[model samples]
Target: FPQRYAHSLFVLRYRTLALKELQVASRKGARNLCSVLVKTIAEQVWAMEHPQYTESRKEPVDGSMVGIQMGKTKVFLRSRAFQQLESLRNAKMIDAAILVQSRMRVFIARSIYICVCSSI
Candidate 1:
């Protein structure tokens, strides 16, 4: 039981460290495919690779991505810097929604036209 408890504590610590690394990467303009290099011990590296502690299933709303690339002695964390305002993000999303709706309308109209021509 003690061994398991120690392992659990290590996992939590490593998870927190990973999150902090991602935050630092995002702040430091960690753009492109690969970014911040996080130094970790062997046990921490193992924890970072663990399925339960490694992957973040839900994406954060700020458009930054959390991805990890393990190296020989460091973990590379990739994330985008968040520099835009909330209003700007909302505007961009609204534009995207409009574009999608317009495309869908066009598709529906074309399908209806095809159906009518076939019937005639």
Candidate 2:
């Protein structure tokens, strides 16, 4: 169930990319492909900020900026792409919501998000 929900969100997240990778075939088609690239990027960043969380008491994704560490592949390091993908996977939450219903829920969610952001 979670996997299917994630796939749907991924489809939504990169609907154009998945389409382009499978169907896009011309210069005009490529234009829309760019939109997917851009949106995927933006969503990736947004998802990073709002990662998957649960109501359980298990250890959560650290909510602090401490112990932060990042690096790339070098003579003794790692690949940049690999690191970025890892970060995105850890951040881009595509199936965080288990149940979604009604416009009011949507409105309140968005409102809270905005309120939190404004506070920052």
Candidate 3:
């Protein structure tokens, strides 16, 4: 029982650290993906800690609002930085599109293009 308790505490601490890393990455201009991932992970952790709430599978709007407010207070990511990251993401998307189109043209005879750009 003591070993299990220690393991649980270690897991919780690891998750807390992972969340902090995600917040830092988001502030460093990984806006959309990082923020969404962080929120989902946080909600999941909250649900796990509160088993009673798990049965409902519904997040309280006020709870989320409060969480958002708390997150804002803890980490401030400037709008300009977010916009810059967005622009970079957009550019990568455009490049991916171009690559896909080129691959399509090349594989036109085969009628199938399997170009996969993993860096989104």
Candidate 4:
């Protein structure tokens, strides 16, 4: 289930590239397609899990940064920072919802057009 979910997310994010590869593979009967997909997913997951340690990531210049802060006993954020973070997250959610809705509408419209054309 997790793999399927991840694959769907990956394909959505890289729709053009994924579609091109899929078309080519379908036409050519690529034998290593599964290995390529597994490798790509593993690389993407690893990149997310272990972001490279750059100079900016090494330390924040200011003490009052607006992100997650970890302490010896607990993890916490300032109220203002938390509010800002929540708003940012909500914005991303809305954007993703909009994208999904637009895609579904396009799919439905295309299917309806095909049906009408085929009947004629």
Candidate 5:
């Protein structure tokens, strides 16, 4: 197919024409592609700017007052937030109805319940 690159390695000879075709394809649906890529980038940016989309940030360890302390980023990323969310999803704890609730309320209620339940 013309759509496929002649070679996966993309040699220089093919690079020019390949780039030209990509440019043509990109131009044909630049708006759509831009919208998609822009959406992806926006989501990534949002995730980067606020890593707590699925959950809120928990209390961070204070380095000055602790025997051992970890940076917020380390704690945030390593937090059980994702795993807990995955389990909630697997357990079907919240279907579509609960998903529409106010973000803060939902998070607070769900997190408290999860924390209490997990402790047992």
Candidate 6:
């Protein structure tokens, strides 16, 4: 199924990134950092692969939801933590939040459109 394929790609991409980070940590002689990063990455990948299903589950699950306007097709303002992480990840090289937000908006919109079309 398309969902399964998408999930696989997501896992692959993250796994590749994690491996690269691990290598960097090792080269920097930060054994503790490498160990912690690998553990966290493994946990995240497992969580994504085996999502919990429960009747008590509510909409807009924490950490998983990325807000975007449906009609206007824009990203809702991100939290402070997200902004900080984005900046940190980019090494302050450029403030590309607008570009990233636009991409997120388009991706979210396209996903919604696909789900709507598929269910019809």
Q: Pick the candidate with the highest lDDT.
A: 4
Each model's backbone clash number: 0, 2, 0, 0, 0, 0
For model 6, residues 8-120, the per-residue Cα lDDT tens digits are: 23333233435556555555543344333434443443344346743344442332232211112112223542343344345433445767888999999999999999999
Query: Across residues 16-70, which tens digit of lDDT does each residue of candidate 2 receive?
Result: 3234443443344444443344334443333444466323324433211212212
Ranking by lDDT: 4, 3, 6, 1, 2, 5
Model 3 Cα shift for residue 8 (angstroms) = 23
Per residue, candidate 3 scores C-alpha lDDT tens digits across 26-100 of 545433433444354445445544658667766433323323212431322234323433454466568879999
Off by over 4 Å in 5: 1-28, 54-120
lDDT of each: 0.40, 0.38, 0.42, 0.44, 0.36, 0.41
Cα RMSD to the true fold for all candidates = 16.5, 17.2, 16.1, 13.5, 21.1, 20.6
Candidates 1 and 5: which is better by TM-score?
A: 1
Q: Which ten residues in a row have the lowest lDDT in candidate 5?
A: 1-10
Q: Is candidate 3 or candidate 4 better by TM-score?
A: 4
The residue pairs in collision within model 1 are none
What is residue 8's positional error in candidate 5, in angstroms?
23
lDDT for each residue of candidate 4 in 37-75, tens digit (9 for 90 to 100): 333333333333346733234432231333333333333
| Deviation from native of the Cα of residue 71 in model 5, angstroms | 40
Residues 61-87 of candidate 5: C-alpha lDDT, one tens digit per residue: 232221111232121212233333234
User: What residue pairs are clashing in model 2?
Assistant: 72-78, 73-78
**Candidate number that wins on lDDT, 1 or 6:** 6
TM-score of each predicted structure versus truth: 0.34, 0.24, 0.31, 0.46, 0.23, 0.25
Candidate 3 minimal-lDDT segment of 10 residues? 1-10
